[model samples]
Target: MPHTLRLTVTALVGLVVLAVVGAQAVSVEPAATPSTVVRTSETTRLPAPDAPNVVVFLTDDMRKDDLGYLPHVRNLLMKRGMTFTEAQSPHPLCCPARAALLSGQYAQNNGVHHNSGAYGGWESFDPSSTIATWAEDAGYATAIHGKHLNHFDADAPADPGWTNFDILLEPATDFENFTFFDGDSFNDDYVTTRLDERTVADIDTWAGRRPFMIFANHVAPHIWFPESAKGDGDGDRGGRLPPAEAAYAHALKGITPRAFKDPAFNEADMRDKESIVSGRPKLAPRPLKRLNLARIRSLLSVDEAVAHTVAALERAGELEETYIVLTSDNGYALGEHRFTGKDRLSDEILDVPLVIRGPGIPAGTRSARTVSLIDLTATLAQLMSLTPTMTIDGEHFVPTLRDPEAVGLRDTMLIQTGAKDPSARFPGWAYRGVLTQRYSYARRINNGPTAGFLYDRRQDPHELANLLSDERYRAVRRELERRYRVLADCSGTACNRDFGPLPRPRPAR
Candidate 1:
C-alpha cells in the first residue's frame, strides 16, 4: 500500500464486516443533551456575512492511510471535500501537535514539545491567544469535547479559549471509567460514541444561532492498558492492542491489513536509517494482524460518529454552511521500521490525515498542496477574518483549497523528533530536519548516533535508502540543511516560505 492510498479490496474485507456489525451493534444514545443548551450569539460577524461554521474531528493516533475504515466519512466528506494527501504534523507527538493546532505555531515557539514537564502537557500551553479565542472574539461560539491535551484533568483550568469545554482528566487514555471536568464519568459507555453524542448535543444548540467551531477529540484505538505498567513509546507495553466496541469485537476477526504490504513494514534493514532504529526485532505476523484488526474495528465507531455529527449539522440546517474538517493529532506507526509507536521521525508519524468540506472548498478533489496542522489552523482563523495577537508561523492556504492550480503555502519546513527524556518515549533520540514536497530529511541532536538520513520520496517512497552520505546527492543535502537552519528557529512569515523546487536527486551512477 502506498502512503496516501485507501485499503485495497482484498485486504479491506474487514472494513465491510466491521461496518455491518457496527450498524447492528447496540450502543448508548448521545448522552442526555447537556443540561445547558449550546452557546448562542446574536451575530456572526465575519469578512463574509454568510461564512460557514467549522467543525473539526480530531482523532488520536490515527494514520493518513487509516481513512479507509471510514465509509460515511468517505461518502460525505472525502467525496464532497478536499483531501490533502501531502499534509503532515509539524511535531508528530500528542502535545506538540495539538499545541500547534491551537496556536498556529510550531512547538519551538509554543513551548509544548513533549507530553509532560516544562516543555510538555496542558500547563505548558498558553491558552490566552489561540484559534479558540480568535473565533470566540470573532463571534463564533466555540466548544471542545473529549481529549484536550495529555495530563489535563479537572484541576488544571487554563480557560484554554473555549466558550464551553468538557475534557477528560490526566490518565485520560482509556476506553472507559475515566472522568471529565463535569464529573459525568463513563463506566460502560464507549468514549468514542459518547464524545460524538455529547458534541451533537452542542451542535443541536449552537447551530442556527451564530457560527460555531467545535473540536471533537476522541481516544479510541490508542493502545489501551490500565492495570499493566505502561511507559510511553516503549514497544507497545508488550504487544497490547486496544479493543473495539464489544459487540463488534470480532467483526474483523479474519482479514489482512493493507499496511502490512507497505514496503516499510518490518523494514529489512536500518543501517541507512535514523539511529532510533537501534534495530528492534521485526513484529511477529499474528500480532501485526491482530493490532491492525483492533485499529480497524475501533474506527467503526468513529466512522459512525462522523456520520452522526454530519447528520446533526444537516438536521440543524447548518450542513452546507459548515466547514467539516477531519484529521488526527498525530499518526500511529503500525509495525513500520519494526517500530510500533509515534515518537520516531518516520513518515508513519510525520504524515497525518487532513480532509475539509465547506463553502468555496472545491468538491471531491485531492490537494497536492503541502499542508500541516499549523497551517490549517491559521487558514481557519484567516477564513474567520481574525487578525491574531500572537505571531502565526503557518501560512494560510485558502488559494489551494479554492483552486487546485494554486501551490501550497509551504513546500519546505522544519520537522523534529521530540525529547527523549521526561517520557523516554524515544530514548536516546532527538533530531530536526527539513521536509519538502518530495524529500524527507533529519539529523539526530541527542547523545549517541548524531547523524540522520534523507529520502527522495519520488524514488524511494518507503524511505528504504538513505541519500545523506551518497556523494552524488550532495547538492540536495546542502540545500536541505541550509533551509533547516533557517526554519529551526524561524517565526511568522520566515518559517512558512517554500524553499522552492528540490534540487533533483542525482541519477544512478
Candidate 2:
C-alpha cells in the first residue's frame, strides 16, 4: 500500500478506537493549592500576583549559535529576557528530551529513553503527571499546538490536562505535507504556518480567560528529503531547504561556525569513543558547510513565526503578563566531529539555547548557571504556586530568573543515550556520562564495550583531547566516574540536589 493510504487507514482506525477509549479515560484532578511553597534553600519568593501566562517556542534540531540567525528571537527574547548560557538538553534526543521537559524527570525516571518505535516513546511516557496537567489543575488554560512525540498517532488521545490540543500525527519529515490532529479531525497543511495560525488564534481566544500555557512547537530546520532524493548519493535529503523560504537561502550562504569541520572532525579511532560516535561515516567539509547553510535558511520561517506570535499576544493585551520561552528539543551536529546528526554525547548535540522573557524576569541579563530541560516542569509549577503529586527530578530555577548572578542549582548534569533497546536505530550502543562545570565523562553501558572518555571542558571546549588514559588526570577522571555512577540511577528530588558548586563564569573575550 502507498504511504499516504496506510496513514489514512491507520488514522481512521485510530479515530474509532479513540472515540471509544476517550470516554473511559479518567480526568486528572487539580492538586491542592499551596499558600507558601519552598522551592530551594537559597531562594524563596512569593507566587505570581495572578497566574502568569507562558508560551514556549520549541524548534526542532536548533543549535545554540543558530540563534544569531534569528533577529526577532534576539530582540524580543534575548534582549528582553535572561539568556541561559549553559543550558543543555539532558538526554539530547528528540523523544527523550521532550519527555524530560514535560515530566520534569530524567530519561530513567520518565521511561522515554529514545524516539518512538525504538525502546520507548509515547507509549512509555506517563502523561498523567505532566506540566500541562499540573497547569490545568491550577485553574490555568492549557494548550499544546504542534509536534508532540515521535510516532504519535490518532490512537493516542489528547492529554487530559489540555483544554485544546493540535498535534502532529506523522513522522516530522516533510515540511509541506504534514498532517495534524486539531482536537477533532486530521488535516494536512504546511506545518509551521498551521501551527503559528493555531497559536495566534488560541491566544486571542484565551486572553480574556485565566492565564494560559501554550507550547508552540515548530518543525523548521529539521532535515527533509524529497521522495526522489531519498536514495540518491547527492546528500540533498539531509539539508533540503524549505520551498517557502527559498529567498532567504542566499542570506546565509557563506556564514559558517568556526567549529564547522574543525580538528576533531572524524578522528580515525573507535577504541576510545563509543561505537556510535567513532563509527560514523566521513563526509567532505564543503558539503557539510552547504548543509549547515541550508539549515539556517530553514530557520528564517521560525523567526517569522515567533514575531507573529508575539504580536498576537500584544494585540490581545497579554504581552506583559506572558512568559515567552524559546528553545529546542535537541541540538543538531552539522559535520561537527565528523558527525552529521544528533544521538551522540558531544556538546554540539547536548548544548541548547534557552531564553526566557516574562514579567519579573530581568531584561538584558545573562546567566552561566548549568540547567537542563527537566527543570522546566518544576519552574512552571513553582511559578504558578501549584504542588505536583509526583516526585520530579528537577528543581525550580526561579532564583536565577530573579537574580542572574545566583549560584548554579545543579553541580553535575547526568547525560545518557538510549537504554539497551534493540528497537533503537543504534542498538546496544548506549552510554552514560556526567557533565560538570569543567569536565565531561562518559562510558559505555550494558557491557557493550569498555570504551570511555574524559574531556577537560575548561581547556578543550571542543573536546578534542581525551584525558581518560592520562595518568596526570587520573584523579579527576575517577571523581567524574564516581559522580556519574551515582547520578545515572538517581530519581525524584535526589536528582535535583546540588552535588557541588559550579565554577564561576569567565568574562567573554
Note the Cα lDDT for every prediction shown. Answer: 0.75, 0.70
Best by lDDT: 1
Displacement of residue 102 (Cα, Å) in model 2 is 0.6
Candidate 2's TM-score: 0.82
Candidate 1 Cα errors over 4 Å, as ranges: 1-48, 225-240, 420-429, 447-450, 506-508
Number of the predicted model whose TM-score against the real structure is largest? 1
In the range 102-179, model 2's lDDT, one tens digit per residue, is 888988788887775445677778888788777777777777777786657676677667777667766445666666
At residue 289, candidate 2 shows an lDDT of 73
Report the Cα lDDT for residue 224, model 2: 65
Which stretch of 10 consecutive residues in model 1 shows the poorest summed lDDT? 1-10
